[model samples]
Target: MALIESQSDAIICINETLMDDELRSILEKLENEKDKEIFGLVCKRWLHLQSTERKKLAARAGPHMLSKMAARFTRLVELDLSQSTSRSFYPGVTDSDLSVIANGFKCLRVLSLHNCKGITDVGMLAIGNGLSLLQSLDVSYCRKLTDKGLSAVAEGCHDLHVLHLAGCRFVTDGSLKSLSKNCRNLEQLGLLGCSNITDIGLISLANGCQQIKFLDISKCSNVGDAGVSSISKASSSCLKTLKLLDCYKIGDESILSLATSCKDLETLIIGGCRDISDMSIKSLASECKKDLKNLRMDWCLNISDSSLSCILDQCRNLESLDIGCCEWVTDAAFQVIGTGEIGLSLKVLKVSNCPKITVTGIAILLDKCNYLEYLDVRSCPHITKGGCDEAGLQFPEYLKVNFTGNVVEPDVFL
Candidate 1:
């Protein structure tokens, strides 16, 4: 009878412990996605009971699709599970599951869930509200990104340095102001293809982020000369690399401003900007001059023979120059470059689709540019055996030379 009484007492103790657990869940109920996942496995009863709350479990498990990590999820600092190679799409998770993860991962500093099509702004806000200590976030290519997600970023992560929102179609300048004012320490920022971002936001960014080192606003059609000017003036001391590719609205004024202000610029890309002319090109060449190395002005319609020559003369430190599809430049332009008087430091030169230039121009380049590593003079009807022989004879030590056919074809000049 005593043994039976002892067993009854043990059952009572078990029930009491569960009651205590229920009370804890109610009082200090952290909606942590990770914690719920762990709590779900405390016993067989809990495991089955939490099966109904699989969505909650996943939030704690992180954005990663890995199966079960209750022990390790509590100590995580950063989570980046961008693209997956999944064959089966699970049905337990909704767009709201991300919110649970954010709540659970409170101490998280960096988070990258780029291209996660399932998550929405609500999920992002949940993270912003939960993980207030975030320092870096990369939500690039998330098509549903709107002011809701951006507002959360402003509300939470204040010490962010890197923010990449490439391909997020809904981002505009209004949220950008909030981001600039709040994230006072941002450094590397990428807004590639964010067409909605206007000049006002660019100005705000320039004014706010005094320490920006790398900025990519490529394909932002709204960003014009005024935007460029703001960036140039604001990022003078800190800006190092700038990409203005496909910014068709930007013209000579922007180039001029960037050249004059960004003195320490190393790489500058103005690909497909049709309105830039000799004056702007000259300004950049003279300002950064030897300091500039990589430059791409491919398909710039306003570029003329005089400006290209001036660039070659002044920017002697140019390692790569892409003047492809510049119709105004003639074979004479190549003659000056090939003559070896202007492009001594040139390693890669692309004058492709400039039909006016002939073999004579290329031959001169091969002779003069002894340090040439890559040369593209494709589609110039005049290019023949003469230019190839000259390049082969002069720069035999330099490898990776491509002048035989097109820019894509790799030829070993050495």
Candidate 2:
């Protein structure tokens, strides 16, 4: 009976294929995987067509299954083999698996191997040699990668636009130089925790990759004012999002340059940049007021209520603000925010560790910013657990309040 059913399905698929255009239209309309799978189960012809037309795939298998996947997903353009959150006990994809992928998926544009620790320079070499048409590559946390492998990629994949090497500790200035010379079209670059990269490498990058829009160099301690100033001037028109978190060497000079040049800046994160003062903050607020939306200056010790008030007054579209650890920030800043147009658009606010901010300030912000979804007032010396619990009663059900150290978990009396 099973054999008869299979033969009947095959006959039906053959008849359906007679009208090839109609069958292709039906296949294109299927957006859900389950629907596509059911359509494929009809027969060998349907399954073959489905596989050939597929464009993206996320595989969790190892080297042994790669060849079979390559044969099946012949037209795949995006492949994600990231094992960052995987729970499987098996060893992850290695150099051999990447070689198979590079050889098979000639048309592939985006490849992500995030946290694939087993892969090393050998795998990157294979990718550079074979995947010349690649546009976006993310090897974040692949600690085994170094300058040689990344240079090969830069030289080979000239069309590369987005490259994320976050936590690639072994990568140094050499790789940045290679990228600067070859990948001129690169727009977004993430070098989070790439400690060895200094101002020299950044200068090289600024001279070449002038079209960069989004850049994250967080925790790059070697980067200083000169490097940032170069990037600001070079990519001024296109620069939008910039993160300089924990870069102690960065001071007001870098921020001033950015404020003067990058007028279209949207998101600016300088958390832990203790030297940033009201001077640069006020300049930034005045220049990029129209486009600035997300601003995080936590631990910016020099910023006072003057800067905060200036930001609230100028940056009308600001959505998320983090002033945690800004000891100089007082209730006056919240007063300005609550009474102004900024609160109408504000969504997320963090004032943790600000001893000057009390329950009154919190009340004013909550009452005015109806759209606020997340509020963090943790460790604020003036905010009491009972006061926060009472305030929580008035908070919207969707609003998340983080009162970690100051408040206990409220219970039901029923």
Candidate 3:
């Protein structure tokens, strides 16, 4: 008999068809959510089994339904109630909803409340006080959260390792101090757009969380050379990824410190750091060349052809590179990348807004970077639709070219 012939028939026979524990275990191993959803619809027993076995759930529905969610999914290990989409404009998860989650999901290890506008300091306090087993928490873009809430989290969630507070503008040095003092095992921290964080906070964090492996201090205007130097000295051995995007106050001194100290850095983003020049690029190429895989220096106005050449020559393991908006970059840099071993492993390259780049450079790039999958040449005046079409014809079918801001026709071989 067909499995989905009728609801009543399927319900009556589901147990007979899927009776063995081995069969149930095999069905439970299906990882796709859509597959699990289909499996759940087979019968009431299947629905109950699926709900109880589910370890991860992304609740995009309204906050009022969280109680129902708790009643349905009792074994959730990771719960994300973040209203990351436009649905956040309407009232989403609130403090009361968070309280229900904190009380219900005792096994919760990862929780994300990112962009949940209704979530306030009270919600965070509930999460901290209740979810002692929480390890990774992302409350990024929760503009209403303040130091009081963060301090409570630090005090309660001692096992918290990954914390993302990007765009929490009100968080000050005091909050960082509290986090550093309490969350000693914190390994990943993101403080992007927290403008008030300065040398004092960073130093405190570095001194306390020496095991930190990833850090994003992007757009923290108050964090300068002194702060970065302290962090590099403390986390150099363990730090694997560091993003200093738009931190205009930091100059070559900070880069020098990082290049000299952080030997294990695999990913680095200095996007919009206007002060970065060849000096630091050369130092990074010499220091962490083999380890570095992803590098972004978008809008770094000072970088020139020499710096690009140095990077391509030394960083042989690079998988992705972005030097978008660097006006000084020319065809010469592209030539350096396309001709050498640098292009073999490079999968993504973005050179948008560079007026000096042309069709000749791009053609060479397409020829050399056999594995390149994504290329963005937006706003490069010299790169025309015809040139891109020619490159598309020559390159593999998997290549995705971004020709925005260029005079290209609709559906032009994307």
Checking candidate 2 for backbone clashes, the offending pairs are none
RMSD of 1: 11.0
The C-alpha TM-scores of every prediction are 0.73, 0.91, 0.84
- Candidate 1 wrongly placed segments (more than 4 Å): 1-78, 84-97, 104-107, 334-343, 384-414
- Each prediction's whole-model lDDT (CA): 0.72, 0.87, 0.84
Best candidate, lDDT-wise? 2
Q: Candidate 2 lDDT, tens digit per residue, 1-414? A: 013235446533345335656667789999898898888888777787788778899988766688888898888999999985556335788898989998988989999999888889999999999999999999999999999999999998999999999999999989989999999999999999999999999999998999999999999999999999999999999999999989999999999998999999999999999988999999999999999988999999999999998898778888888898999989888667656534457777888899999988888887777788878888898886688677674778878788885443222100
Q: How do the residues 317-384 of candidate 3 rate in per-residue lDDT, one tens digit apiece?
A: 88788989999989898666655544558888888899999988888787777788888888889886
Which RMSD values do the candidates have, in order?
11.0, 4.9, 5.3
Alpha-carbon deviation at 50 in model 3, angstroms: 4.1
Candidate 1 lDDT over 296-410, as tens digits, reads 8989988888888877777777777888788778856654554435546877788778777776666667667767777776665655546657656444656455555534633
Ranking by lDDT: 2, 3, 1
Please report how far candidate 3 places residue 60 from its true position, in Å: 4.6
Which segments of candidate 3 are over 4 A away from where they belong?
Answer: 1-50, 60-64, 334-343, 386-397, 406-414
